[model samples]
Target chain A: MKAIVVERGENTPSLIETPVPEPADGEALVRTLRVGIDGTDFEVLNGNHGGFPAGDDHQIIGHEAVGVVEDPNGTGLENGQLVVPTVRRPPEGSNEYFERGEPDMAPPGTYLERGIDGAHGFMSEYFTSPEEYLVTIPDEFAETGILVEPMSNTVKALEHAFASRSMFDWSPETALVLGNGPLGLLTLAMLDQTVERSYCLGRRDRPDPTIDIIDELGATYVDSRETPVSEIADVHEPVDFVYEATGYAKHAFETVEALAPNGVGVLLGIPEDWTFDIDGGRLHREIVLENKVILGSVNSHLRHFESAKESLARVPDWFTDDIITDVFSPINAEQALSSGNNRIKTVIEFDTR
Target chain B: MKAIVVERGENTPSLIETPVPEPADGEALVRTLRVGIDGTDFEVLNGNHGGFPAGDDHQIIGHEAVGVVEDPNGTGLENGQLVVPTVRRPPEGSNEYFERGEPDMAPPGTYLERGIDGAHGFMSEYFTSPEEYLVTIPDEFAETGILVEPMSNTVKALEHAFASRSMFDWSPETALVLGNGPLGLLTLAMLDQTVERSYCLGRRDRPDPTIDIIDELGATYVDSRETPVSEIADVHEPVDFVYEATGYAKHAFETVEALAPNGVGVLLGIPEDWTFDIDGGRLHREIVLENKVILGSVNSHLRHFESAKESLARVPDWFTDDIITDVFSPINAEQALSSGNNRIKTVIEFDTR
Candidate 1:
């Protein structure tokens, strides 16, 4: 099996021949179809993110993947079906969270996230996944099934954000998403169901195709470099929900300021340690006086994956088309792995035959 | 009418004779019985909390009071009925939040807070309030009804903390209350109903009455000055919910690290502007990876006040008795308002005549 692998602390991942995996009982042998590359994969290659398997000298670098079960191995999983495996698995002697189907909220250092952390990834021609970890997608979404991984995160974030406001009769009319990447755009797409007005913020100075996609989704795109998020509220109204995926530490603080009264900020960014000055006292008072909620959510559960599958199944064709800006063949796998900013999403293709 | 009035930018409050208030149409004349003095009142006197009312040189120094209706003025409130008037009222030409019965979540600078920010307070022998602003309490809690104001804030915080965790079956077993002040103690009293192993952290060194109350309620009291909260988890298990009432900004930051997976830190503290060095990057990662929630809750709504009245109704007599340490007449109002660190809660009393 040809796999894109990166040695520990290596910046570049190279194609290598690894032994093909076998399906054990209750596991399925899945042939990789497509793998999406995002900022997290880049972090793992650069030794920036946590959860590198302790004993493995090389880490397979991809978490958002789509594939087909070649062999069910008595798991009841059907062959010729597209599936996206969940990233995080329960830790040693699984705690109450995982026992209850909530590995997404498992205690830190307890779960092993495939590709980005402790487990081997699905960025190979063949990988085996437990029957419970794989969620099937409809045949209609085969081309875009890889998106289910990232989309599920947005699904879980929205679930918790709405849950935070359940104390009162909260109906948010507006939302702000702080980033124009694949995850941010997906968040904007999900917010359409909950809010009337949604704004997407990015660092670009001019019009981009991603901006057009944002507009096509009935959301306004504001260039953070020219028009700050604070000014966006001035031009419009204070955002009731802010989905932050910028991976910049400062935007987390700025998201706090961007919230309306009783607003919720769902943070999904993982940034480098950078000290920024903030008026701790005023922030405290604002949180207390305004009843603000900031939730830090990572990973997703099986339910979220199922929700993401439904979202993709019913989504407008244009959204799925515009999101995956570039796709590369196995020969051009390196290009897909090292995607530039010009692309909204870059995926590497694999052949089943 | 004799009132405790603190002139703007002054620390000393004087007992001054002011004109007794009269009930206007759709209003009720309430005969003030007793007003509880918390740290917020002291902040008002020291010019560190909020401002004096417009067109007035002084701010009345109380928001937590238990009183009786003298005249309903055709508003349907029965005379001699025990009541606690809310401190915050909606702004002129009320907004959506106020109209929806959530004035507590009103945007900053939009609502006027009685005693604390804009409107006059309840620290007078006679006061007038809108009929809708008053919540009735049963006769059994008359002596402890003054605790309702602070308890309402905790009620709202708990409501939100649970709301944030509503996405899954997250029933917390352990809790941590970061302060032994009146507000922190009240939070412990509330957490008693939800969790099993509740812990209270305070700066006190030796055996105190508050600790005794915490023990009596089946909660552990940690002397923060001796054993830091970070170590509390090391000695025991990591906490699931932390109610922060310590007016120190650093505790809010530390609270994030002390939480378990899906843990929520409900911040009720209003600290001064002191910038502390924190690893923002690491903190962001902790939030994302652990699925932690931090909610900044300030005020409460009528529902919360009613819920607080219910909590107080079912509370043990010893818990209520030990909380209110001292009660003073109008002549000793200064002593009541200027309670030292040793006291839990102090109140200034007034006669209905």
Candidate 2:
């Protein structure tokens, strides 16, 4: 079997040959169909974000993945069944989070991501996973199942943002998406279902595909160079909900001033260490006096994956076509890993069948 | 009738002669019994927080008040009934907050606070309020009814805090109260009923009466000067719920590190402008990875006042006696306002019955 791996002290992916893994009890053998490459992959490649597999110099790195079962190995999974694997396997110990089937709520240093942390990823020809970690999807998702993992995170973030306002009559009329990245576009598409008005803020110039998609969805796109998040209320109306996908740190505070009364902001970005001065009192007052809430969400639970399946089914086919701009074969995986920000979404194809 | 008023450019409260108000068709004339003095009153006197009434050079300064109805004016309220008036009144013209009975959630400029902003407060010997603004209380609350106004705010804060976590099975075991002033003490007293183990953080040293009362309640007293909030998890177990009552801006950011996984912090303090540098990335990462929530809560609605009446009834007599350390007559109201931090709670009595 062939796999793409990032060795210690090396910040680039390389082709490596390894033997195919045999599925043990309660495990199923899967042949990768497609694997998504994201910003986390860049972080892992640069050795800046996640950890390497224990006792191994390299880790196979791809979390947003789709595969077809090759061997059931006595599990309930069927051979050739289409499946998507969820991220965040429990660490080697007694973890109440995985015990309760909620690894999404687990604290950091307690759980490991399949591709980004202690476990080897599915950016290979073959992989083995516990049957419980795989979610069976319909045949229609075979081409787009690689998107399920990222969409699931947005599902959980929006669910919690609404849940935080469940105690009041919070009918949000307008929403703002702080980043025009892949995650922000998906969040904007989801909010379009409920929010009457929506806007997406990005630093991109015109003629960008993401901006075109924002316009196609009937959402206003404000170039962040012309209008920052703090001045959003002055340039446009204050939003009732803010979806922050840019891990810039300052947006977390700026979201407070940009929200209308009784609004909520859902934060999904995680940034590196940076120090900055902020008007802490104004941010505190807006939240306290206006009855606002800021919720921090990361990863996704199994239920969110199920909801994401329905949410993805609702997205028009043109969006999927417009968002995924690059698809690379395993032989050219390095090109997919080093793609610039202009690329909307990148994927590595292991097998078509 | 005599009233305490704050004149323009003078931060001191002075006695003034005024006519007893006449109850209109929808209004009820109330004779003030006792008015509680809090930090908000001081802010109004300093002219740094709230605004003076429109077209007036002076503002009456008391909001935490309990009184007896002298005239019902054909309203549902009964004459001689014990009543507590809510602080916020809808601004002139149509307002949605007052219409929905949720003035607490109103935006900052949409409403006015009696005594603190744009309206004459209950500090006068006689005051008029629309019948809908008064909450009827039991006879037992006559002595302690003044506490209802401040306690109502905590009720609203805790209610929203728990509501934010309702989607999960959140059973908070340990809690932290960030201040030992009147609001923090009341919050700790309320939390003592449900939280198993609790701690109160204050700068007070030994032999302080607030510390003694904290001991009486069986909660650990932490000297914040020695143990900062950032080191709470190392010094004591990380808390599941944090009640912030200190208006110091830094405590808001420090709360992110003090919370346990999936925990929440409810901020009730309102601070002034202060610029400070913080490691924003660490704060953002902790919230996202741990599923932590920060809720900002301010004034209370009418329902909170009703719940507060019940919460007040639950307090033992010794607590009520020990907490209210100072009681002053109107002629000595100046002394009441300038009392030192050693005083646990202060009140100015206008009438005993």
Candidate 3:
């Protein structure tokens, strides 16, 4: 069997030979179908962040993927069934928090995320996961099922934001999402169904594929490079909800200025250190007087995974074609990983064995 | 009638003569019995902040007070009935937000807060308010009902913080409150009946009256000077709920570091210009990965006012007496406004004129 591997502190990933994995008790063997390459994957490949599995010099890194259950082992999942496995797993086999049904809130160092942290990932010929961690997908979603894992996080972030706003009759009329990456575009797709006025901001200029997707979803695309987030409210209305996925450190603070009274800012970005001065005194006052809530959310729960599939079920099949820009076979995995070809979503497909 | 007036740009409050106010349609004339002076009053006296009523050179500065309805005038109020007049009024006599029953969340410049911004306050001998703005109290609360206005804001702040945590079964077991002023003490008093473990952090050394109030509420009094909020979790367990009322800008950010996973930090204090560099990058990560929510709250709604009265009804009578340190007549009003006495709450009182 072959696997995608990134050496410790390496800037590139390559294919390598590896032994096939066996299913353990209550776990089923899965043959990989497709693995998506996201910004996190690029970050892992560059060794900017994410930890390799302990006692191993290289990490099999890819958290977003769709696979077929090859050996059900009577785990209830049928062979040839499409499924999306979750990325995060509890450390020490399991912890009190995850055992209590909340692995997303696990404390630092107590959770080992597949591919992104201290465990082997699904970017291989075959992998194994316990029944509880795998979310079954509809047969119609077999080709684009890899998006469920990434899109589930967007669902959870919005769920957390709205949960915070349940005290009032909170119908957010306007929304601003501060990114145009795959996650940001997916967020816009979800908001398009609910929010009346929506905007997606990014660094690139107009006439891009991301902008085309935004237009297709009836959302306005704003180039953040020309119009900064601080000035967004001046050009448009103050937003009730801001889905921040840009991973820019300073935009987290700037979003405070763009929030409406009693607004909710859901931050999803994880950026490197880039400090800037802020009128924190004024920001503090707005939070106090205006009843504004800013919450940060990462990862997702099993329910969120279900929500992602439901959301995708509503959109047209061709819309997935707009989101998933390129697909490649395992022999040409390097092009999928290294290409800067205006790709929104790229994936490496594996032959089911 | 005598009134407490703050001249524009002046740092002192003085007694001034004013004509008795007349109630308009759907309004009632009230004679103030007691006007509670909290930190906002001191801040107004210092000319640090506070806006005068439109076209008025001086601001009548008092927001929290207990009074007697002097003239019912067909507004459904019995003469001599005990009531507390709300401090804020709609800027246009009524706005859509106020009409929709959420005056607390009204847009700025569209609302005027009596005593603090753009309206005369209850520090006057005779004031008039619409019946809708007056919250009636039981005769037993006459002497101490003045605490309701300030305490309602605390209730609302807690309400906002908890609303954000409603997605999970977020019954916080341990809580931390920053500050020992009236607002902070009131917060501790409210949490005494709910949370299992509570600690109030303040700069005052032991044996202080504030510490005694915290002790009486079965909450630990932590000297913040000895153990700053940044080091709080290092000493005690990670806090699940943080009520910040210290008016220190940095403590607002420090509380973020001390929050437990999925914790809530509710901010209340309005501080002056105090800025410090923060590892915002790290804080953002905590919010994203740990699913933390930080919200700021200031004013309270009519329902919150009703809730405050109900909360006051549940407490022992002598407890309120312990909280209000001094009450002054008109002749000694300057002392009430200027005295650097270690008073928890100071008030101006009038014989039921």
Largest lDDT belongs to which candidate? 2
**Candidate 2 lDDT tens digits, B243-331:** 99998888888998899988999888888788889898889878887888888998999989999998998988888888888989998
**What are the lDDT figures for the candidates, one per model?**
0.85, 0.89, 0.84
TM-score attained by model 1: 0.92
Give the worst 10-residue stretch by lDDT in candidate 3 chain B.
Answer: B270-279
Q: For all the predictions, what are the DockQ values?
A: 0.68, 0.75, 0.62
Looking at model 3, residue B33 earns an lDDT score of 89
What tens-digit string does per-residue lDDT give for candidate 3 at B1-353?
89888888787887899899878999999988899988888888886554777788898888998889999878989998999987778876688778876777775667888888878888988889999999998887888899999889888888888878876667799999998888888888888777899999988766778888888888888887788898888888889999999778888788888898889999888776655677778778777877888898878778899999987876666568778998889778788887655788888888754
TM-score per candidate, chains pooled: 0.92, 0.96, 0.94
lDDT of 1 by residue, A235-320 (tens): 76788999989988777767777888889999999887787677777777677778898899988999999999887776688898
TM-score of 3: 0.94
* Shift in Å, residue A80, candidate 1: 2.4
lDDT for each residue of candidate 2 in A45-112, tens digit (9 for 90 to 100): 99864688888889998999999999999999999999999988989984988988888888888998
Off by over 4 Å in 2: none
> Which one wins by DockQ: 2 or 3?
2
List ranges where model 1 is wrong by over 4 Å. Answer: A7-11, A18-20, A47-59, A91-93, A205-207, A215-218, A227-237, B7-11, B17-20, B47-59, B215-218, B227-237
Error of 2 at A242 (Å): 1.7
Q: Rank candidates, TM-score, best first.
A: 2, 3, 1
Q: Against the true structure, whose DockQ is highest?
A: 2
